[model samples]
Every structure is written in structure tokens, then in C-alpha cells.
Target: MGLNEAPLLFNFEVESSENFTFIPMSVRFNLDRFGLRITLAQWQMLPLEDRKLLARFPVDDDTEIEPNFDHALFEMLRTHANVEPEWFTPEEAPLWRRTDSVPEGVTHQAGLAGLTAPSVARWAELDPFKRYVLAKLSRKPEANHDFVPAMKEFGGGA
Candidate 1:
């Protein structure tokens, strides 16, 4: 779905019962296809129950849904997935925001301690979630060289 019409993103997790791991049915964007589509806003609003339901959905590295900031989608996500809705903004999410989950004093800025211009440009072109991956991959000093080239290639900077 388009961003304007997109839905909330539900991440599934499996729960174990006395006998087996049960997949809790819930309403979440199915990402068993190409493209990561979802607003960052809706993702942060997900309550515990929503996350639980998402955890139950069959997911793998291939799943490609993202959260957005549509209220309807957020409400639908909660109702359909059995969760309490909260006021969450995309900018408030830590994952979306840059952090030192990498190393302190390190950053993505150019020259001082970051990637090249082409690399940043390429990274800028990527969707936020994909950007997150690139950021994570490039966060460490060891991965900077490879990530810069990869970002440049990814964004067609070369």
C-alpha cells in the first residue's frame, strides 16, 4: 500500500505453551514480498499485545514491512492485532534515530567520522529501514570501508 494509505507494522514473535509454540493470529502487514512499506509512526505506537501478535506471525529476514504514522492504521493495527494504542511519533523511535548502539564518538557525518559524499547521498535515497541497516553495518570502524562502497553502490553514487 502507498504511504498515505499504508497500515501499521506488526512484528511477530512466537510464544511457547505447554505443548507447542503457538502463532497468534493478528493483523499486520505481510512482508513476504519485495519492498519495505510502512510508516515509522505506527510502528512506535504498537503496544505489547500488538508486538506479541507480530512475533507470532511467520517471519524471517525476508519480511519487509515498516511502520507509519497513520492514526487509522495505528488503530486498525491495535484492534486487529489486540493491542493498546499509544501516541507515538516516527521521530521518537530510537531505531529510526541514530544511536551509538555502535560506538561512542562515532557518527555518519562526512570527514570528521563518517562516509563519503556519494555514500551519504546513496544512503539518503534509501528507505528509512534500509538506511537503518546501512547505518548498523557502517557503525563500526571495521565496516566503514565496505559500507561506504556498498552505500555508494546502493545509491548509485559511483
Candidate 2:
């Protein structure tokens, strides 16, 4: 996600040893999931000592850092910001989507939609995430037993 969408928690400008220039860094949290994104203008801004510390862990291209690193990073950030981490139960987590983006394959499936007019209509009213789940379940190559249950759970089926 871009900076606009992410909630900015902190911004740090660290001095680089090479040219004594200050580099901009930001710590942003994504509401889509529980994660943080750290942006550094140049990799050189990271101290060799800090690099050595993180070398033991696998850092992937995706912003989702390793759990160990994540915990340490958050702890360090919390210490700097003087704030505690907010906790949320599963039930309190934000819903993934609010509208459906239905695919043509799903709309045209005779076997899937022929006998489920009411369910299909109800599916249109479900949140995008629920619709996505149902669509995915419906498109499986193998026998799909979960579609009906999912529809029922969402009040889509009789």
C-alpha cells in the first residue's frame, strides 16, 4: 500500500556515515492486516551494526518482516513513541471487504447458479470478502461442497 493509505506512526531521519546526510525513514502500519512497513530512502542509512543484527533472519521482499524482527522492531518503536500496542480480538478485527467484484465465470455457471437464484441474489448483498470466499469455493475444479454451507452461513440459501 502507498503512504496515503497507511497510518503513519513515526518518521525518523537518521544520519548516514558516508556523506553525513540525513535520510528519511518512516514506520507505517497497514490496517488491512497486522503489519508494519519501513521505508528507507537508501539502504546505506542502516548502520552496519544494525545490519549485522538483522542478518540472522530472512528478510523477504514483501513488507511482512519475520515475526522475531517484527516484535523487536515494534518494541523499539514503542519505546521511541512511548506508546503501547493496541490489541484486538478476532471478533473485533475489521471486515475485509464491503462490496462484491463478481467474476463472469461465477455468474454464468449453470450448475452453480441455476438452482440458487435466491442465494445468488443474497450473495450480491454480502460483504466483498464473503462474496470472494463463496466465489472461490464455487470455482474449485473438484467437487465443491463448501459453497452451499458458505451461502447458508451468509443467509444466502433457503
Candidate 3:
């Protein structure tokens, strides 16, 4: 099934028991990014009470979900994953570098920091995720100071 179908596939109910406190299953991280896919085997490994708690956790569209793992059961699943996540190299991932789409503030900041054309091209060659992070950081007022450091870390000249 597709990612859109993931929630539906795991949907079900469990009887509540006084012995087990059913907390919401909302851990704050994107499980998909970590390549953690909990399936029936992992679910079965968890105690019935833990299962009940997980079933109640809701998923939302917010990306700022903090990496909260207060739940012991959730931590166990992450640590002992049934499936491993496929890692990607910088070249393998998607590229989002469009010179026109890049905000002028970012370019100005880079220029002020003494980043030349070669440096800018190097920045463009960075993983799209890193580029995205730089773009986001560059848009903040008075945040341009971080731009050069980030560029240096990403293989651009200072």
C-alpha cells in the first residue's frame, strides 16, 4: 500500500483495561524519514496495553513534530525495527535548486559573505534537503550570518 494508505492499514481498536493506561500514540517525529515502518510483527511484539495506547495516537500535517519518545513501546519499535530504512546519497536524492526560485535575500547574504560564483554553484550542488534548510534560514531577517557557515559546512568556500 501507499503512504496515504498507511494509517488506514493500521486502524483498529482494543479494549481498555484498568491495568494499562492508554496514552495517545503521538510521538513527535516523522517515522517515515527514519525508515522505520512498524508492521504487524512489531505491533504484536508490543504488549496489548501498549498497542492500545498506540492505536489512539493521531497523525497530523505539521512537520515540527518534536522527537518525543516518552513511550517505551515506541522507543522499542524504533530501536528494533522490523524493516530498515533505505539511505540516500546526495546525488541520489531529488534536487530543488532553481536559481530563479532562490530568494534574493539569500543571494545577497551569500554575496556579502564573500561567496563567489563557484561557491554558489557548490551550494547548488548540495543535497536538496540541505539547500532547503539554507533557503529557510536565509529568509529570516538578521539570520544571514548563518548562511556562510552553512555554506562552508556544505562544501562551499567561506
Clashing residue pairs in all predictions, respectively, total 13, 0, 1
lDDT of each: 0.37, 0.39, 0.43
Q: Pick by lDDT: which candidate is best? A: 3
Query: Compared to the true structure, candidate 1 yields what TM-score?
Result: 0.28
* lDDT, candidate 2, 25-116, per-residue tens: 12211211334444333323455443333333332223445445556545544544444445443223222232333444344342564434
Q: What does candidate 1's lDDT look like per residue over 1-158, in tens digits?
A: 22322222312122121112222212222321222234435444555454444434432223333343233444656665545344332323334233324323124423333443333344345554444434444445453433444445445323
List the candidate 3 regions with Cα displacement exceeding 4 Å: 1-102, 117-123, 141-143
RMSD of 1: 12.2
For candidate 3, write residues 1-158 as lDDT tens digits.
11221221111111222222322123212333232445445555666544444433334323244223234445656555543333332322222355335456566666777774234456556655456546654665564545665666666544
Candidate 3 is scored at a TM of 0.34
Deviation in Å, model 2, residue 73 alpha carbon = 16
**Top-TM-score candidate index:** 3
Better of 1 and 3 by lDDT: 3
How far residue 38's Cα lies from its native spot in candidate 3, in Å, is 26
- lDDT score, candidate 2, position 43: 27
Q: In candidate 1, where is summed lDDT lowest over 10 consecutive residues?
A: 10-19
- Predicted structure 2: lDDT: 0.39
Worst 10 residues of 3 by lDDT: 5-14
